[model samples]
Target chain A: MKTKRIRAGAAAMTGVLLLGACGEGGPGGSGGDFTDGKLVLAVMNDQSGVYKDASGPNSVKAVKMAVADYKKKHGDKAVVDDIEVTSTDHQNKPDIANTKAQELYERGGADVILDVPTSSAALAVANQAKTHKKLFLDVSAATMELTGAQCNKYTFQWAYNTYMLANGTGTTVTGNGDKNWHIIYPDYQFGQDMTKSFTEAISKAGGTVQGTIPTPFPNDNFATFLTKAGSTNPDVIGTMQAGGDLINVVKQFNESGLKERGIDLAVGLMLITDIHSLGVDQFAGTMFTDAWYWNMDDESRAWADRFRDETGTRPTFEHAGNYSAALQYLEAVQEAGTDDADKVVAKLEGKKVNDVFLRNGEIRAKDHSVVHDAYLARVKKPSDVKEDWDYEEIVTTIPAAKAFPPAEASACSM
Target chain B: MNAVLQYAVQGLAAGSFYALAALGLAIIFGVLGVVNFAHGAFYMLGAVTAAVLLDTLDLTLWWSLLVVPVLMFAFGVVVERLLVQWLLRLDPLYNFLLTFGLTLVLVELVKQKYGVSGLPYKPPKLLSGRVDLAGVVLPRYQLFVFLFSVAICVLVWLVMTRTRVGMIVRASTEKPDLARALGINVGRWVTPVFGFGVALAGLAGVLAAPFRAITADMGNNFAIILFAVVVIGGLGSIVGAVVAGFMVGLVEAFGQAYAPTYAQILIFVLMALIILVRPAGLFGRKEATA
Candidate 1:
């Protein structure tokens, strides 16, 4: 799969110059717009790494579905005749992402990039988008910087961020009497952001921080950190590691008899796929914040059913977010009557959206964050699971206003 | 003090996999003189195979520990005969590149079959809980892994020291040209020795199947750390691999416990120090360095 993605990239690189020449000669080759005939939506993320399951090829599939559904809905009124989706594996490396993002914009002829997952890698691609003046809808990465200091006119943080996750889980968990907290986070931009956000949320909810431990990114083992966290005798241990790292921590915590020792785990961020991988029993009764859940309502269930038919697995929040972002981007293109980044950005800014994934979603004009209602969900017991992948039960809803940081707080001047 | 004991036990348990895999790397480097970059892939394959066996045939972890290594041994033998044996006479870099390529191919193939989400492997219920001894609490499986890997290391060490076959293999490993000149048929042991080394890696993989994430790229980082383990253990030293394995594990544990940020960096620091003090590794024979 990795080799295939590389081969595809190589092929695209070879065709770049020729494609660029042809694009300039097209009908709408004016200075104000750039749309040859088709719109290319490129999905770049950790295609073959730990985060793959959450938003890899499945995200690509969701993008394609968005195009198809758009075509079906608009029919003759569709702005673009065709929408093409392409994807590549950044392998969760920022340097690789920078190169691939450049390639996607220069030679790959991508109009918009979708679902760049890792916070650092996503930020790298955001820089490329800003440079190339292309749209980048970040559906998966959880860093607030994309909407803060690093925010760009060309990039949109679509699904969720560390602020939303920490606000939902940290406050609720601390408020439940687990006041003393020890945090273990992957030592990266996303992890650091999650730690800071969770600490803020915990303190706001009348709690004191015990300590915070930084573990290696993409690390397989967490025994040492778990031991260190336990040494402090905290009421709750908050883990900011996600995907495979989160699974390992939860598994190791279960094995270390920490739950029996009465030390509760507060997950900073979690995905349905992660819960499915470790089984519902391991994470049963655990509370975490979710951007979207497949079984939330009838409309969501219907979309998820179609998604299951396509991918043979239930969709994570990221998959739904990708679909929503892609569809919204296309709608914005239709509203603006062009694939030009500036026009699309104008159309999307401050737009209120209600879709299967984004409930009460608003594309804020200030920071480019698509703020939406986040759900505080608890993992159901194994017996409570009525069907496969039925993992979460929504406990409460954190409104859009409370879910994300206010627009004035953003460091982005634009 | 109890925390110290806990960290030490935890470190040793974590070291069990490294020790087992490094022993295989040492053996293969010792005899075949081929740096098996595919060793980690083989370790990944072992875990994948064990998970698959459990899923399809309902084989338990007990069965996997016994069955997976044997399968890996045969796989190693075939790999030697079909691929590695031909590159024996070339520059070791050629073989290293070959194994490196093999690692990619194997990893991609596994990823194709099992999506990157990783497979689930639950340890036996008996080994699922914790064991408390004198106020120190440790996972039951970690304790089992530490003890089991030590037993296998001792058994392999005994065979190398006592058995005629092992003696011949060791002679060839210690001095291949000299062994040939001394009327020992060193070439005949090449295939099995490689197979045995691979089996040790496979055995380690089986031990780790329940303890770690069983994914395709699981071995990518592992292989890197393993190289550090090998370098610190002395490239081709048998005892060094096992000793350095546990030693690195203990160091990693203590470092992680005390300095969580610099835990992984500490392994390389220790390796660099060992290399500076003794170019041929801690227990490596001086002649082997040449």
Candidate 2:
């Protein structure tokens, strides 16, 4: 009887300890630790699918790195309670991503949604952000419509956009020398926006768009398109294709022996990930525009070095953009002294956000589009590469004023 | 004139890939009486295997071409024994449903494993550059794909007609009960026949890697088109499949060239017109009951 009583007492103690552990591990644990209260910043980015290889995982890592840096800088008195990062596989579907964003906001308490690659999905999430009164920092979606006709007060385009890319690279190249263009674009919103922006910029800069071919998305074979491009025989082939589509087209163009045909490729927008996969050897001497490059300057290089050390891969434009957006948002929140959406947005507007990724960048009051310098880069030859990840040469830095389309050109009423 | 010739050549080159993929679908359906929806998945796997082999084992295109098919053949055998065997006793619809589900599982698994940026595969050095054909500059890789696909189709035809195993399988497909009663052991032949079908898919995939992106979801679109090809061609007819594959390729090529916007629509329209004209397809056997 005595031994049975002792066993029951031990069981009771075990149950108490288990209950205590569960309580402490719950969502509302350690409430008094943060004087300003913890602000949960949920990051929802594409963690799988086509864009996964380019921006998904890296975007998440970048936000985490930025949060870590913020905490280190603020020392012991950092108002940030804890940053909780969660992601979803949008699979380039707007409906799915929008739904996931809503769930993240309502239940997950996501302060900001970052690096939505697909424009359609970005627009959907932006609408949700407006409804929920949350900050939506768009890091990757390139469609000008996000800041144009569909511009929301809640959404801020932090990185590059179609207008900026076209104006910076297409117009600059066409204006300088190569006037006539044979363009091949994907038949989609992003592609349409890119082609329109490029054509308009080229025309405005006294250049001619001789021909344009609109191909379907995820088109595997571009032999026919390349042939058609070659037949046009313009001074330059302006490719607005991105990701795998871009690589396939460029490779096929090279293999078509058209490089010797005097039809140089003027890439409107090329990501470092695409170049890395395709190899710089084949893409040598090609001029393109990018929002960020790892080897841009000392500060950029240092940040890239640290990022590479942590992530084991070079920081992509979208990845760097995520960092920029997160850091800027955190700064805005700090300045506002509250998590209220309007107050934070007010603090963010026209605020000069100085970071390793971007310098002297300010969120535009009219459209919430972050204005920053874009780099015109040429692919470095194999011999020029002193090490891996050193694949680009910054040809010129296009100023913010000349990089993006004029506000008057935008269809946004605000 | 030069521009027209270039477009034609380009069309034929792309048509070759569609033909190759369609031919594989045709062979699997013709021999097994199973609408292998996972044929395109096998094609995708073939390309991915080649890319992975090239990356991991430092294998060249030649080695990958040889090795990938064998691996896929083994995968086919396993699939047949484990999943397809049960459906063989059931209706053809069951096989289709099973294969469709299998495709989803395989594609999702690949996505989970690889995370879909699409691994790049380089063409062999010999077939890397372009060659001028009658004043039309053509990608050498495309030319090779066309030639390779034709060779494979011819080879498959030769095997189906000449070999004893092919004769038995073809005979069984035509008269399953008779072949079974004659002690041909249709059960024994099922696994190898399935393996051969899978091998054809793998071959198409090996040929495709150099031209297309090797993504997990790459097969989904191609599979739907392959189904259309099978319907347009006579079901279970190798000759019909070959002819229809090239025919569809030409149609798609010309359609895209002439009307870029309606190219995809034109394919379905052609399929609809063909179905309306000949319910059994271009070479399909008309049902006596119908």
- How high is the TM-score of chain A in each model? 0.92, 0.90
Question: Weakest 10 consecutive residues, lDDT, candidate 2 chain A?
Answer: A21-30
Tell me, what's the RMSD of every candidate? Answer: 3.9, 6.6
The sequence of per-residue lDDT tens digits that candidate 1 reaches over residues B261-282 is 8888899999999999998888
User: What is candidate 2's local distance difference test score?
Assistant: 0.78
Q: List the residue pairs that clash in candidate 1.
A: none
Tens-place lDDT digits, model 1, residues A1-414? 446435545555555545652222233332334454568899998777778888899999999999999999999988787577998999988999999998777767689999988888999999998888888999989888899999999999999999999999999999999999999998989899999999999999999889999998668778989999998999999999877778788888889888888999989988888787777888899999999999999999999999999999999999999999999999999999889788899999999999999999999998999999999999999899999988899999899999998998889866
Candidate 1 residue spans exceeding 4 A from truth: A1-34, B181-183
Would you list the clashing residue pairs of candidate 2?
none
lDDT of model 2, residue A284: 89
C-alpha lDDT score of every prediction, in listed order: 0.88, 0.78
Task: Kindly list the per-residue Cα lDDT of model 2 for residues B179-231, writing each as its tens digit.
Answer: 98888887788888788789778878888777676778778777777777778
What is the per-residue lDDT of model 2 for residues A324-347, given as tens digits with 9 covering 90 to 100?
888878777777766667788899
Model 1 chain B: weakest 10-residue lDDT segment is: B114-123
Winning model by TM-score:
1
Model 2 lDDT at residue A7: 54
